[model samples]
Every structure is written in C-alpha cells, then in structure tokens.
Target: LPATLFSATVQTPWAGIVAQSPLVLVLTGAMWITYAAIYFLATSVFKRTPQDAAVLSLTVALPNYAALGLPILGSVLGEGASTSLSVAVSIACGSVLMTPFCLLILEREKARAAGENSGSTLAMLPVLMWRSVKKPIVWGPLLGVVLSAIGIKMPDLLLASIKPLGLAATAAALLNT
Candidate 1:
C-alpha cells in the first residue's frame, strides 16, 4: 500500500492540486466528517465496541478511489483532468489521518484481548503512536511527500519494479472492497 501511495504521490502534481485550496479543504473535510459521524454513531447510538466502531467507520468512509475513481475518471475525462489529483488527495488524507486512528484502536483492542496490562490511554499513547508510525500504510505517503518536497525523484527502474506490486495491491484492495 505504501509503495502504491509513493508511486501515486510521485506521479501526481500534488503541488498544483494543493494550490487549489478549496478542493483540498472540501475533500479533506468531507472525509473526516464522514469518518467522525460513522464512528460516533457506531459507538454511541449503535452500541458497538470502539474497535468495531473504528473498523466500521473507516471501511464505510474510505472508498477505493485509486482502483475505481482514477481509471473511470481518466477514461471519461481524457487524462488531463484534475481527477488524478482529487483521487491522490483523497487517498493521502485517508491513509495519513484515518488509518492511524483505526490502527490505534485496533492495537489497544489487541492488547486488551491478549490480557496485556496496557495502561491508560494517555500512558499507552507513545507506544500506540510508535506502532502506527512504523506501518507502511502510514509512512509510505509521508516519505513520498518529503522526497517530493525535496525534489528527489524515484528512479524509473525502481518504479517499474514496484509497479507490479502496487498494481497487485490495488487489485487486491478492490477485490476486498
């Protein structure tokens, strides 16, 4: 997933997309609000466990934009549209902001289920954060962003080799979805 994210990031004109502040804000805001709504509803109204609520919310909120949105939009809009940027921004926001929250909840749940003496949420925060940071899904786009910001490019050979795996990841994700 990180490889896919890195590839998408390096390929997309993120700077140009980000320059359109309204698009960025709207996309980011919409995703976050959707996630929050589902999560709170699941936990409060539906009486789901935090772990279940987190998973349910993220699943419902984050779409498979790369597999579905990019191909369809590119085909219909004829390649030069802002669609790729929109998809990339959506993917980045979902991976960076939403995934970690789900991971943190899942990690806490895992520790609890295993009968580990995990402390209070505040005490567990550092460990949870470190675990989240180490995930490829979390760090992949982050590394991509940093490299792009510094004007460093992935060599074509590396991209070619990783392309297959990235595509496989996309297909698997689509199938799962």
Candidate 2:
C-alpha cells in the first residue's frame, strides 16, 4: 500500500478507536507523566542532586518505543494501519515531547548545580528547547509530519534511497538491545 493510503486508513480507525474510549488518551498521558514524576522523586531522594535526578528520570521514563515496541506490535498484531499509527504515536511522543522535556529538566538542574542565577536557567530554556527541536531525532519526524499534512509526496527514489538506512537502524537498535 502507498504511504498515503496507509496513513489515511490508520487515521480512519483512530477516530473510532478514540471515540469508543477517550480513556486511552487519558491513560497514556497519565502513565507517562506518572512515570516521569516517580522516577524524578525516587532519583532525587537517592541521589540528592537535581542533575542526577533529572538524568535518571529521563532514562527511567523513556523507553525505546520505536525499535522495540514496533517490532513487538508487528509480530503480535501483524502488519496493519493500527500498528503503524501506534508506532508513529509512540515515536512522536518519545522524541518530540519526552526527550525535549527531559532535556529541559536536565539543563535546568545542571544550571542550578553550577550556581548559575535562577533567572539564568529560565532565560536559557528557550535556547535549550530550540536546540532540542533542531536535533535530528525530533526534526526528522516533525518534517515528515508537516510535509505529509501539506500533501507533499516524497519522491519514490528518495524513499527507496532511505529504506536501507531505516532497516539498518532498526537492526542496529535490536542488536544493541
């Protein structure tokens, strides 16, 4: 199936899925937030340093959703639009939101540890966020999303060119795990 059709089918079922139970969204959000909070509190209590707590919280909260979750979902559920959407949602949340949020926390903690003025950490947040946004992990999927939303079709040749790299990345991640 074409990428466009795959996306459309994924989106079609997603509305129904969401309509059937709004609780999924609520639960997902609450779960991630709770995980972050728990890790932050636990690490802070044990480490007794804001920087260490922030770093540990990130590791504890964020999982390798793309590499691991996608493969497991694919194997158990079989290939389908829902699986694709699930993978996309997991990747987007992990990369765009969680990674940047953790980075921000880490930066703030580091600043505090360095004895920077409190105001300076606040001042530095936008810069740190911009840096996070610019990172390839965040930017690549974001660009793909924007382009797809605008109905821009990627060239077949370009897609063909990147297929190997994507496969290689998945393989590398699996091997590392």
Candidate 3:
C-alpha cells in the first residue's frame, strides 16, 4: 500500500491538480456530504448506535476508489485526464481528513460503549488526531506527496523493484475489498 501510494503520488501531475482544484473540491465536498447524510439517517431514522451508524456511513460513502474508480475513469476519460486528477485529489482528501473524522467518532463511541469517560470531545481531539495521522494509510501518501513536491527522484533500480510489489498490493487491496 505504501509503495502504491508512493507511485501514485510521484506519477500524478501536480500542475494538472492545481488546474483542476475547483473540481477536486467539489468531489471532496460531495463525499463528505454523502457521509454526513448517511450518518444522520442511520442514527436518527434507523435508531442505530453511533458506532453502527459511523460504520454504515463510512462503508457507503467511501467506495473502493482505487480498485473501481481509476479503471472506469481511465476508460471514460482516455487515461491521464484532468478528471482522473480530480478523483486522485479527492481520494487523498478523504484519506487525510474524512478517515480521521470517522476514527474519532468510532473511538468515542467505543469508549462510551465500554462505560469509560473518554472526556470531552475537544479534550480528546488532539490525541486522536495525532494517532490517526501516524497511521501508514495516512502518512505513506503524505510522505510521497512531500517527497514529490520537493522534486526528489528515487533511483530507477529501486523504483523498478518497488513497482511489482505496488501492483501486487493493488491486487491484494482489491481482493480484500
């Protein structure tokens, strides 16, 4: 997964991302809105517990974009299209932001279920945020992005070695999904 994220980050065109920032924002916004709506409905209408509602909302809102979205998008957009850039950007946003938000909710719910006083939300915010950011899923792409932004290039031999592993990881992810 880290290898895949590194490749995707390095390969993605930063210029195209900046050019299509507006569309990327729209896509990210839509995803968050969908998550919020589903969570609200699940909690209020269905009378589900917070933990259950969060899980349902996350499952519905965040599809396997890497496995499904990229292929379909590449086909329709003829590959390397700006629209694909938008999807990539939105995926990054969801990974960095929405994921932590969901984790925070779920953790709080878990604590509540265990009858432990997890303290106020604001008090726990920073620790949860830090924990979430430390996850490989969050940090791996971020590291890639940071390296790419600074124009660092891995040796051809090293990248070659990693590419197959990345591809295999992609397949593994799809299989898991």
Candidate 4:
C-alpha cells in the first residue's frame, strides 16, 4: 500500500507537496486522527464495555517523544527551528496515521459486541468539517506559508511568540514521554 502511494507520487512528478505549510500537513494529520478517534469512539470506545480497551488503545498508540521523534527531527531537519517544526509536523502526521487504525480495530470489536452493524455517519460528516475548519493550529502553518510565500512576513514579534510556544509544547511532550 505504501509502495503504491510512493510509486504514484513518482509517476505524478507534480507532487510539489513537500510539506508546504506545516499547518496543512499538521491539519491533515489531525483531521485524520479525529476522524479515527470519532470512528473508535462511536464504534469501539462508546460501544465496548471493556476497560482494557483504554489500556490497549494507550499501549498501541502514543509514541515515545524523546526517542523516535527527536532522532528523526535531528536527522532530517538538524538542530534548529526548521528541525523543530519538521519533527513536530512529522510526529503529528505519523500519529494521525497510526492511532486511528488501531482504534478502528478496537471500535470494530466494540460494534460487534454491541450487536450493531457498521457504525452510522448520519450525524458525523458536517460536524467533522466544521471542527477541521475551526482549528487554527492546523491551519496556522499553512497560513504562515501562504502569507510568507506572498511576501508577507508577519511581525517579527508574532513569529517569535509562535516559536517559543511551539518549543514549549515540544519540551512538555518530551517530559511527558
């Protein structure tokens, strides 16, 4: 499956999609995660009667921040703001890809137990897009890139503020890890 996508990307040769805006990549990831989470919540978390599912979900999901993410960022982005942003974006994307699938399996087990067929989407779609649009962090990177690309550098102070907050979040994650 991954190979196929890689091949398609190669064939396309127009996928200038090299992490244009950290926000777009981040949002796409988050959108994926929430979609997965809601799927699990509706199908597994809500339906399942097992406490172990929570533990299983935790065990199967969250990655080691200080370990895997740091090395990847260091290797790819080096030790700088760009590295920090890249690592943060990559970690965010990777989690969205993996966590939801695990939760889906968990949810499917739950839906089965609850005697339900596949989950329903009657009340899910609109709200999901709304949530996606409302998220600023997800759009921030994209917006920043767009604004920058158009010869607009936000005030230095604002950029400075964003950087510190980003670093703080990363440090906090490392501590939690």
Candidate 5:
C-alpha cells in the first residue's frame, strides 16, 4: 500500500510508538514472545517429520526483512519518516542477526538425529542466545536506533549526496542479487 494511505490508517499508533520508551519496549517484547511461540510450535507441535519440522521452524523463524518488512514499512511510514527509519533498522536486522541462533538449533537437531548425546544438553540455548546477542546485525540497528532517537538530523547536503547513492546502490544490489 502507498505510504499516504498507510499513514492515514496507522499514523496514530505509530506516532505513539515513537513517542514513548516503555511502550516501545513492551511492543518489542510482545513481538519476540510471539516469534518464540510460533517458532517452537512450528517445530514441536505440527511437524510429522524432522525435515518438516526444520523447514517449518525455519519458515516461521526467519525474518523476511528485505522482502515483506522493508518495503511495507517504507511504504507505510512515508518518506523520511522516523518510524519508517526505525522499522528500516529492524528490517535490516536480517539473518545476520539470526544465523547463530539457527545454527545452534541445527546443531542440536543434528546431534539428536545422529543419536549422539549433546553432553550437557542445556548449554544449547545459552550458546544460541549468546551468539545471537553478540551478532553485528543485532547491534548495528541498535546504534541506528540510538542515533535516530537522539534526533540526529542529516544535513541537506549530506542527504542530497546520499539519496542518489542509495538509489544507485539499491538498483545495483537488486540487479546483482
């Protein structure tokens, strides 16, 4: 949908999101809780086979940041909208932010599939969380968020310089990809 229409629909709540800290944290927490439940249930409850479970888990677990997320937020939040920028930071928190967690799960599943003991069995989750927390994708967006929250306005000259560069870069990346 177009940004204008999306703005007309979501502007009130989106504005409130940007306006407060506790609300933001609550929303973020709710999102993660939802994701965890979906991922766990996708793997545990619904799958008839291991591969089915893996695929299910991955599908629910993966964030299609570059696809559904970025464009949708960009459209909804409109040009130069801070909330859009905020969502941009999150959407760009792509698999890089998540690969380690994926890897850790895959490791345990592989061990179980191979009928080998993972020794302590409990180390898996902490390791996965640690890896995810330490990842660059997780932290990079946080830095962007901090800058944005501080109202760091880009200068006209800087923005002008970056705009075409962004367009060209996107076109090039799309073509190459």
Candidate 6:
C-alpha cells in the first residue's frame, strides 16, 4: 500500500484530483477529534482512570482505514472514483492530526498519575509533534506529496520493485478478511 501510495503520488499527475479540497482534510480531522472527545467523555462516566479513558477513546476514534477501507473502496468504487486519493488524505490527516491529540491525552494522563507537571510536556508539544510527523507512516505519504508537487518521476526499476509489495499488500488485506 505504501509502495502504491508512493507510485501514485509521485508518478501520476493526480495531485489535484487527490487533494481537491481543504474541506475534506478539515472534516476528516474534525471527525476524529469529535469522536475521540465523545468517546473519552462517555467512557469517563465508568470511573476508569485517565489513561484507560485515553486508550479506550483511541480505539474508538482510529478507523482501520488502510487495512479495510482502502481495499473495499478500491474494489467497490473503482480507482477512477478517487477513492485512493481520499484514502491517502485520510491516512495523512489521521497521522498528522489524530495521532498527536491522542498522544497528548495519554501523556497528560501519565503525568497526572506520576504527580508531575503536565505543563512541561504541553510546552514541548511542538517538538514532540515534529518527531511524530517524522514517523514513516506520516512522512511516507508526505514525501509522495512533495515529489508529486515537484513533478518528480519515480525510477522505472524502483517502481517495478515496489509494485509487488503493493500487490501483496492488497492481497494480504483482502485475505485477512
């Protein structure tokens, strides 16, 4: 899937089609935040610890979009429907936006439990966020977007080598269900 994402974002001229609107990205991020908030609040009524609430909320908030949504959407909607692009955007938004928020919640919970000042952790959030975004899951698609924007073409041999991995990802996803 990463290989296909790299190929599509770099080799194809579909950036405009993939990233049609900022609204989609905004809505995706908002949905995750709303879901997490709601889940956390709802779970709080159960008398669980902050960390437990954070974990429960995270499980409810993060969708299995890559492993489930992408394959189903590609098969059901067809590639021309821009499902791949939507999936890519969804992935990017989830990684960049949802992950940090969840981390913050978890970190706060930990600090509270340890009787430490969470203000220090909050102050370091930007650095922590930068580190989080450097993760391959986040940076891989980000790199693809940058390459696509610059009109850089992936090497044919590299594409050929990674094509199997993409195919295998799709196959494995389908078979797992």
How do the candidates rank by lDDT, highest first?
Answer: 1, 3, 6, 2, 5, 4
User: Which consecutive 10 residues in model 4 have the weakest lDDT in total?
Assistant: 4-13
Best by lDDT: 1
Model 5: clashing residue pairs?
A: none
List candidate 1 stretches off by more than 4 Å: 115-118
Off by over 4 Å in 3: 81-84, 111-118
Q: Weakest 10 consecutive residues, lDDT, candidate 1?
A: 11-20
Cα error, candidate 5, residue 81 (Å)? 4.4
Q: Please, what are the lDDT tens digits per residue for candidate 4 over residues 23-112?
A: 545655555565546547744756753335443444444444323555566767676655545444443343334434444444544555
C-alpha RMSD of each candidate structure in angstroms: 2.1, 5.2, 2.8, 10.8, 8.1, 4.0
Q: Give TM per candidate.
A: 0.87, 0.72, 0.80, 0.41, 0.46, 0.66
Off by over 4 Å in 5: 1-24, 48-58, 61-63, 92-100, 113-116, 124-177
Top candidate by TM-score: 1
TM-score of 5: 0.46
For model 2, residues 21-42, the per-residue Cα lDDT tens digits are 4444654585478666866676
lDDT of 2: 0.60
For candidate 5, write residues 8-93 as lDDT tens digits: 22222333335654644554455456556767676577744544554455456554443344455667776555655444533423
Q: How many backbone clashes does candidate 6 have?
A: 0
lDDT for 119 in candidate 3 is 84
lDDT of 1: 0.78
lDDT of each: 0.78, 0.60, 0.71, 0.44, 0.47, 0.64
lDDT of 3 at 13: 61
